[model samples]
Target chain A: MTAYDPARRPRVAVLCSFNVDLVHGPLSEALAARGLPSELYFSGYGQWESDLHNSASELYRFGPQVVVVYPDLRDVVPAFGSTVPSKHEAEAAGAEAASALGQGIETFLSRAPGATVLCTGLTVPPVNALGLLEGNAGYSWRSAANAFNAHIQDLSEGQGRLFFLDIEPVIQRVGWTAWNDSRLWCIGRMRLARDAYPHLAAFWARAIRAMLTPRRKCLVLDLDNTLWGGVVGEDGLDGIQLGHSGAGLAFLEFQRAVKTLPARGVLLAVCSKNNRDDALEVFRAHPSMVLEASDFTAMEIGWDDKATGLRRIADRVGIGLDSLVFWDDSPVERALVRRALPEVLVPEVPEDPALHAEFLHGLEAFDTLTLTREDIRRSAMYREEAQRKTVRAAMAEGPPEAFYRACGIEMTVVRADDFSLPRLSQMVMKTNQFNMSTKRYSTAEIAAFMRAPDIDVHALRVSDRFGDLGIVGMAIVRRDTSPWLLDTFLLSCRALGRTIEHGFLGFLSRRATSAGAGLRALYIPTARNAPVKRFLDELGLEPVPAGGETFHVTIPSGLVAIPSWLTLTIEE
Target chain B: MSDKLLYETVARVLRVPLETIDIDSSPETIARWDSMAQVALMLEVESVFSVRLHSDSLMALNSVRKIRDALVHLGALPEAP
Candidate 1:
């Protein structure tokens, strides 16, 4: 996914209006010129209803790693018509339209839960009505377009399935007249002409890539010669050069940068080639050591191969090797780790220690789309995982099931509230490996759903003898007259292989049935969510394709027994 | 400029064979005309010609002709494109 290879095209699904993009010509050409392989699903121009369903199907079939929806002309007709309703009425209409569209999107996403969907927020059309009515139409159109974009943003947040690409800043920078000449917009006579706009295309492509790819979770650091000017073992812990003066200041700035990552949700770990006792003493005793023992989730301080040390750190923290970025001054150690774990990213350390700060900042390999609560608590989670391993090892004398049961695992399912909103939104945004709808949401939008009467959302918290996994799973439901639509269902990657999702859904279905809901229609069959696509099928729920990736199931009112392995309780 | 200097700059930028570059060579003329190579080329040109190119100029300098024109504008080359 690096910008190096042209042939390594990411499968992209373009879901937007099928119209003449007169102004956005350059954008279109730029995408084409890059040789970016894409499947364009045009919602017929001015035909919102048909386009919505068609686009959904296209999204499912294409199963693109990234979904880019251009809302250039989709909202214009509804915005400009004389019969357009007031804000409240328009909101109600938008909600209805969104729900219907969501069903199709849900189906598509269920089939390709790992794909990152990018929705280009509505663009202002170049139709100025100055001659028509003193430019009142232009003003009205801009106002309406603003409202439409807001709704799209809300929908993106609520469904957790869309990334809002706001082109306003880029459009403003280019300006209207300049933008017109720049081929960012189509003007008179040309109508739907498209010109090649490489700059804007590059911006959009970079943004999309940043959103889809996972950033490095853990930074494995070497302390001696790398973090400071000298080896702690040879120079003595107190004698190391690290502080606000000379070569020490450079290390200090690097420490500051590494420390900031944890706040930004990047966990720090240490894998130093030094005696365990000496390294620990240096970390504890050094006055200039801004990064302490507590900063790292795990540390491997020994003369073991750097590759072996990184493996131990990764295993202890319960993360894949690929998710780690190793930093070492020794090229030999770096090369060894690179050979053993080619997936692990090892950026080159500059010869001059003073240039470390600039080198670290210049590395774009660890960039992510958005930071969520999971990121903030990632270090803590890894710490808990390490503790869990020790506890499990102690209890390993008996059968695994006995040890797990003895851990006093208790599950709690509660309707999502402000307290659990961050975690729930995080599960939607970042949980890729075990997600049913690779949907992403914002804190504000998830809060809005909690306030909505028609939507039912639940968050699950699992606690064991070791520690509490605070709000690890979430499910959002939209109630229609006849059936309850499972809008979104996702669990953290750590909670996988536990049958927690199945248990959670069983509990949810029972609750829904008790609430007088008869049918449970799940929009499933995403590429990355196959684990749950046949979930209802295994439950004896007959699945019939309702066009696209949606499935309708009629649930019997009988009390279905949840998996015995799961010990469940409900929280109000 | 001698072929040696041009080849050195091209090889450093492309990280490819010095033998692959010629006076008439362009991004399209080379096998590594990917996004990364484009960026590397821009960086190399900046270093070799000692000239800062604007975003538009960077976009325009895909071909050797365009690069020659840019170098002339930056006074790194003498009246030739």
Candidate 2:
């Protein structure tokens, strides 16, 4: 389990339109529970505008990585509690209020010093002029709030690092009355009830944790009651209520949802306590089964306990148990997995079959902020690796170096263009293990850097005989004469340990030397980036200030000796 | 007994000990009773007592006695108090 690190977890500032002293306790408690202890900067009530505009405000002084703005409808919208307005008047007022919100978010972003801002959606008052009729059409309080939320969504859609958390769903779950306590509001002018702090703060905390940790690589699933209605072995393949009708719709929908996981880069695995043949029969011959046998990345079916099966699946996938989520409808199986592998996220599936699809859809644990080409092809890449493993095992050599050399690896290095921008940015965002500087960049930022005359972005592609590992590496260099600075250099974990980074650095060194400036890089040590740090230090890059992070390596203007195994090509 | 609950509630919100909170211990005296903690204490008092404090009483609720007096005036005293 990832332990809470108060100093390292990104700092977040909560700037609200109301007093938030009651919030810090539960918010801290929730964040601590998730292994992300926050160093919070809570602005005083009604100081949001000043916190954003005033350069010397505590918000900027804290230099937080995330700023969660809690804007209540009473303040952000017009006539929130005042006299009800006509439909036209309400619609116009909603537009104006939404624009003001956009402007506020823009102002906060401008002054935030590179912090991502999460503006919570405005809560629509249930008992408005139109009441339930407002949801049907026209401008009621609900429609007006929806309009504001739509505009908020528009702002985030065009830009990176901006998001609008739809607190409406949370409101729907918790109910408006409980979410907003009248007694607390009357006493202290707090936006939400004292107890609602954890629920509200959880939205921001989840987003932040997703940003900090790499996404869970695999999803370990259970068959029988989890995938479909009834046990496969007991019910038999013909009796399974998968795609028949009515109640079977729930099972079919759940199957479809599980099938869709792999497309989003979540590898699937089956861990069932049923007979292997009985389970495979459903995927093989059952016409109603939405998931095919090929959909699963690994399988550990039979009479074994789900706990052992999950470990086997994780081991087979070459990912840690922490990087897996187990879904089992049976509480007994779920309990066993939880006890044996507590690190595995075992979400409680709703008891009612009808709620299964909704329960699966509501899982924010699988939320990934960005997607890349590498992500799209990740499942195929893993499948191809299985083939490579078989070939390696058949060969005389058992070592990786011999296998890599024998595979006839080919490499291509090119400047990041339209074709490579998405993957390059994704590598920057998610690649932590082999990254020299753990800096995340959006596609827009990567495009901006590429357009700059002083910056050069290198996108690398490597392929062995088994398959081409798509754009797997990136090296960004700030090219100024006399001392070119290596801004961010990273390679995916898939292509590490082959002296590929050495070739990447050598390529950069030659490029820098030709431009009359040699290569200079800095290795800021992080918990995950030790591989890059060790590589840079061992490659004889002398530390400029002797034990400092800044390193300089001189490259003679000649053909730098890359590894003999790699058939390298450098595209302009 | 109600006064003890009030003291304990205040202490809980401020993250201090129950014994540390006394009748005369105001924001001026308690280190945790800053502007931020004042808001926490106000809401907690309202929730615990189920009394909606008037704006003046809320602002004036600086010390333990002031809170107790305001709750008593509202007749929203706890079961023990």
Candidate 3:
């Protein structure tokens, strides 16, 4: 609904060892197809080293948020093409090249702390001195390239913003002959064919988009031919084909692939037009079923239309419908859902079951830049939410405070540090309903706030009898003003409905009172943030008439009190 | 391929006006048809005609007439056309 703003999109800079200026056109086209139009800057030919080391270089002046570093192995180690190098020489060349590139990247990171650097692994030269036996040769060009890539991979381990994109798989997918254009290389130093740039650029564009946008949280799958070989209700559990051999093996491979998604914080749910009992029987009795019934966060196995089923699944999981990717094998059902709910991503299901798993691999919806502890434990948190909801429903007979007291709610507030920056930035970008001000601050901006003397950024973690909700809320306060200004305040949707919002505000009020400052928070209304207005009114902060888009309120020091039932912990 | 289609493809790849190009146009004649545009032109030619250009003639196909002659020599286009 918002107008397209090119300046707001992510700025990308490419620094390659070869003439890859041709990539700019196709790379922009690929990103535009993903609905993320980016501003791209290409460094001059073979000027990566100068652009990285010099702080006043044009690359730094461009102020890129994402930098792609592509250094070809043949360009870095020229001797690999002419002579069959020894093991010691190959390893030395690889190490020296990696170290130099790594040093330049480290310098670039120092200049742009918030920028993400995607350094590529070296691709093996298609032709080498050793010919067909090169891979078997102990210290051939392949090993040298591997050594360089391994070192590049190691550089990204501790560096939070640095990522290593392996290009070998892409080259292998497109084939070496088609990927490289010897004629173009000889004519204009263009190492890649004109058409091959888009295939390689899609991966980079996805990674950049992940850094800026919230990732899809759930994958809604259909039953029958989609999940397995046959319909459960019609064919019966025994007749369904799913195992480690024949056509069943392909279904098993797809199931195994879906099962791994949960580990990466992607919830799996079922939306099928089958009897509930029949589907449950297959999940419980099937010996070769890779995904158990317990793995699903929610399931809608009824005779309802898939559009309605998908809505219920999204509601039960507390995620937006736009965050759900529906996979159905039937063209009729896929077309119906596409017409009914266009926001839901419906990837074309391959008719051949053998290609199903491969089709799943090409999905870019769930791509992310980093994997945090909170991400790995997200599914478990959702499972715990279901239990908490059941308990809350039973306690509905009593007053709201009774439920809060019975749950033994505990809240922890800590100053934002390097350890909590990634999750904190993610919460800032994704949390919408309880968010006030709704400013999408990047990790670098949050770090800048942390370094400022007058600004204090706090990360709130909630836990109870259910489980530990890791860093579910955050607030940024500017202390230079008379009444400390709350620049940003938000709580994760999963942590809501538990009165944690009240406790979080009380913690902030107490912190301000201790510093002899009253708190003034802004409640900026967004399309999805109408729920945040009532919470501010309940705290009884008198509104200070503001002329701008935000509704400003002044919080009295002793007015907002922390409830006795809620235990509060403050970490230094 | 028709001469009109060839000139249109060259103009589009070079990002110039169609009225500015003819059979005698070359890199020296058009400012936009630099080394980069030449590479892009070769690629567009290969894809448009569905024929691969030999590596030896990649640099030699400078003028529009020469490219047409090479395509004819490869039997990609009729000699008279």
Candidate 4:
């Protein structure tokens, strides 16, 4: 289980209709298990306005960190005998509905500026209503849903507070009849049958979890039919279908999908069964290849088995294999890789090639909590790191310290401000492996802490002969009676193994000594935070054998001199 | 189900002690009975009883006593003492 602070529960307001959701039970159970507290407000049967207003008020009063509004499908269902609206009319109706919904959201946010709102588009109903099927209304209903979703996404992006949870793809994946059979919907009667509710609840729970969690940092992909239409070994570079025609378009779209991952800070790497030359030739020569060889941080293209290739990719990138998701077209190959590296996620590919686009979109497991400046420049950063490794490996007969000195590694520690606060909070939330406490905080909470009189928050930025590491580390200390409590101490794993942790702690010690604090108290061990635990032990913080999750260490006024290799600059 | 299993499920969902809960406890009586806790308690009851509680019934299961009545109504537990 992820470590959660019981005192700081993230309040969530769920604004949706109460008619019937088939899977509410499992979803509620899942949220409870994860320690997320949520409140639900239902609009009385078929009363959209009442539901929206009531939900808005509930959310405002609760001052929730996130408000999820699931529009009632039954209320949105057109009158039983109404004629199907033309495309223009349907679009107009959709625009009108979106405006109304947006207004309601604006009103709610005016009351609670700190809250983040998420609006889920109307899910595909299990049964096409009689009015919908008659007079080409089915397509119109879908169009209206799409229009509403687009408007919500636009509003969210504009306000920087709204998030649209696209539930359509999930519904399409399970299919309408199968979903109804599985008891995932309430349909016309506004009630779910008892047997089907748990599964329905599980679906919602999974969707919510995906939305709230931070996305994986790396995407490990397989070649052959997965990236291109055919194996490069079998078809050769010229013979492969990858550009402007039939199966080629599918491969083209897949390339486009892989390209976007890098833009979102998900480092792309290839794990395939092919000659390196052949793969390179395709990447260079293929006109349809939207993804250039430059896009990938590392490429493991060889006749070597995929499992070995995956391991090599992990080694080259210096990220855990568990953080990667592998994509492949062949089930046999996927199974082989999965069996070899069980920690790596290998999702099943849809049988139909047409569904590939939808499959790629439904991968919300890799969606990010928030985008930062570092995220925008991540690919270039990884490329630079790779270059740094090559430079170090090539240098022979030089002292390690001399080599580091020659490279000129410098760190700048800046005091927290509004501009850097979001990135700082992001590091605190996502930096799990190297984190001491594994503390996760909402942006509002972080902002409040920065404003508090007794708290000191510091942001660390690193740059070397190669490039800048952006804002990579953060430390939060609270002044207490005896010691400055280390409320949060975390650094990105990319900055680890370089003694950046030691430099950060050294700086913290200097600051504590200057402030007349005697000790640094740190919260102790979690499964993912062993690296920090080891670091603390190395720093001579005697671990008291207490059974719970707290650790204390008294730092002498004079500890160790700040390492000369780390040239540190402080900014107030 | 045994009272022990039932109370354990509730405790696990609430992240509290099994001993702290009793048959008379409900949303109104339990200090932790906010909307979120109410939802969690209902989910716990459903899993422990292995029976689905309708959304309406879940709304009504505010107290431990009310939840016990719901369990009996759903044939998940015998009539309460």
Q: Output the number of the lDDT-best candidate.
A: 3
Alpha-carbon local distance difference test for all models: 0.66, 0.77, 0.86, 0.70
Each prediction's DockQ against the real complex:
0.05, 0.29, 0.44, 0.03
Model 3 ranges off by over 4 Å: A1-9, A132-138, A391-466, A471-572, B1-12, B15-21
Clashes of each: 19, 1, 0, 8
What is the TM-score (0 to 1) of candidate 4? Answer: 0.56
True contacts kept of each: 0.00, 0.55, 0.36, 0.00
Global Cα lDDT for candidate 1: 0.66
Error of 1 at A102 (Å): 18
Candidate 4 displacement at residue A274 in angstroms: 2.4
By summed lDDT, which 10 consecutive residues of candidate 4 chain A come out lowest? Answer: A181-190
Model 4 scores a C-alpha lDDT of 0.70
Q: What are the chain A TM-scores of the candidates, in order?
A: 0.51, 0.70, 0.78, 0.61
> Highest DockQ, which number?
3
Candidate 1's residue-wise lDDT over B1-81, tens digit each?
A: 533665677777667788877767776788876654564566567766667677566555776667776777777777742
Better of 3 and 4 by TM-score: 3
lDDT of 2 by residue, A93-146 (tens): 767777876786787777664688777887776755566556355547765677
**Residue A557 error, candidate 2, Å:** 20
Q: Could you tell me which 10 consecutive residues in candidate 3 chain A have the lowest summed lDDT?
A: A1-10
Q: Give the candidates in order of lDDT, highest first.
A: 3, 2, 4, 1
Q: How do the candidates rank by DockQ, highest first?
A: 3, 2, 1, 4
Query: Scoring only chain A, what TM-score does candidate 1 earn?
Result: 0.51
TM-score of 1: 0.49
TM-score of chain B of each: 0.76, 0.87, 0.93, 0.80
